[model samples]
Every structure is written in C-alpha cells, then in structure tokens.
Target: MIVRIMGEGQVELDDAHLAELNTLDDELLTAVESGDEEGFRRTLGALLDGVRRLGRPLPDATLEPSGLILPAADATLDEVRKMLHDDGLIPG
Candidate 1:
C-alpha cells in the first residue's frame, strides 16, 4: 500500500507491515478516545516513525494515488479526531 503523509511525499508499504501498523493505529485510537494528549503524541510519533522506518520512499517523480493518507507529523489530537470521523484515513 502507498501511504501519503501530508507535508511529506509518498511511501510504499507492504502487506508485511500492515499488522504492526494496525497495532499502532489501535493505540492511537485508544489515545484519542481517552483524550490522552501525551499518549496521543507518543503513539502518533511512533506510528509516523514506523512508517518512515519501514516504508520505501517513492521517488519525487512518482505520482500514483495513495492507498491511505495519514496526518502530518505536526497534526494535533483534535485535527486527527476530525479526520477519523469524517474520512477513511487509515485502511485496516
């Protein structure tokens, strides 16, 4: 799957990474649900770091649509919560 992080370019992630990503996503959701700002920040950072670490960066010339879109690294909890209810930002 190709995921686009806003403010950054695209990264190609494979099926092998999905399970771990899902776990991170769950942690993020839990943080959001509980309104835990610290947890949200920590988990969100970890999630983005995982993507950067595990995903292959697509070249600048690549223009394929992203299969999933994640918020920017600087995204706030309220911003992400808005994204969750209104958009299919994460794919299971």
Candidate 2:
C-alpha cells in the first residue's frame, strides 16, 4: 500500500507492515483521546519512524495514489484527532 505523509511525498509500504503500524496507531488514538500533546508527539513520531523504517521514501515527483494518509510530524492534536478513522490513521 502506498501511504502519504501530509507534508511529504508518498511511500510504498507492504501490507505485511500494517499490523505493526496499527499498534502505533492505537497509541496515537489514545494520545488524541486523552488530549496529551507530548504523548501525541511521541506516538506520532513512532508511527512515522516505523513507516520510514519499513518503507522506502518516494520521490517528490511520484504521483501514485495513496491508500493511507498520515499527519505531519508537527501536526496539532486537534488536527490529528480530526484525521482519525475507526482504525486510526492507518487501518489494519
């Protein structure tokens, strides 16, 4: 699946990585729900880091459609909370 970071280009990630990402997604959800800025930042960073670790970055010119859209690292709690789905940012 191709995932897009709001301020960055898209990266092609395999479905095999979805489970791990979902675990991080849960942390994000908890942070959002609890209105914890630091937790949100930490969890969001972990999620993005995991994505980068498991997927290669795409060139800026790449135009493939994205299956998932992640928030930017500097995203505010409200912004991220609004982006949440039933399964968090990246659904498992």
Candidate 3:
C-alpha cells in the first residue's frame, strides 16, 4: 500500500502492516472525537513512526496514488477532525 504522510512525502508500506496501522488510526479518531490533543499527538506520532519504521520511502519523483493520507505531527486537533471519515484516516 502506498501511504502518504502529509508534509513528509510518500512511502510504500506492506499490506501486512495495515492491521497495526488501523489500530493506531482508530485511536487517533477516538482522540480527536474526545478532544484529547495529547493523545492525538501521541497516536499520530506512533502512526507516522510505524509507517517510517515498517515501510520503504518512495522516490521523491514518484507520483503514484496514495492509498492513505495521514495528517502531519504538527496538525491541530480540529484540523485532523475534519479529515476523518466513517472509517477514520486509514480505511480498513
């Protein structure tokens, strides 16, 4: 799966990592919903770190479509709130 971390370009992540990412995504959604800025930051950091740790970086020139898009570490809670869908940032 091609996952894009906003402001950080894209990475090619294995499908096997989806389940773990989704778990973090769910936590992110919950944190946003409950207005927990700290949790939001923590979860978002974990999610991004997980992607960086488990996925390979795509070339800067790569322009393939991204399967998922995640907000940056500095994103505001309200900003992230608007990005959520019924399935959260990472769709299962």
lDDT of each: 0.86, 0.90, 0.92
Instruction: Name the candidate that leads on lDDT.
Output: 3
Per-residue alpha-carbon lDDT of candidate 3 for residues 43-78, written as tens digits (9 for 90 to 100) = 989999999999999999997899988888898999
Q: Which structure among the candidates has the greatest TM-score?
A: 3
Clashes of each: 0, 0, 0
Provide the TM-score for each candidate, comma-separated: 0.90, 0.95, 0.95
Deviation of model 3 at 22, angstroms: 1.0
Candidate 2 regions with alpha-carbon error over 4 angstroms: none
Q: Over the stretch 1-92, how does candidate 1's per-residue lDDT look in tens digits?
A: 89888899899998799888888888898888889999999998998899999999999899788888889989999999887742134566
- Model 3 CA lDDT for position 47: 91
Tens-place lDDT digits, model 2, residues 1-92:
99998888888899999998899899999999999999999999999999988998898988899999999989999999889987788766
**RMSD, candidate 1, Å:** 2.0
Q: Candidate 1: deviation at residue 20, Å?
A: 0.7
Q: How much does each candidate deviate from the true structure in C-alpha RMSD? A: 2.0, 0.8, 0.8
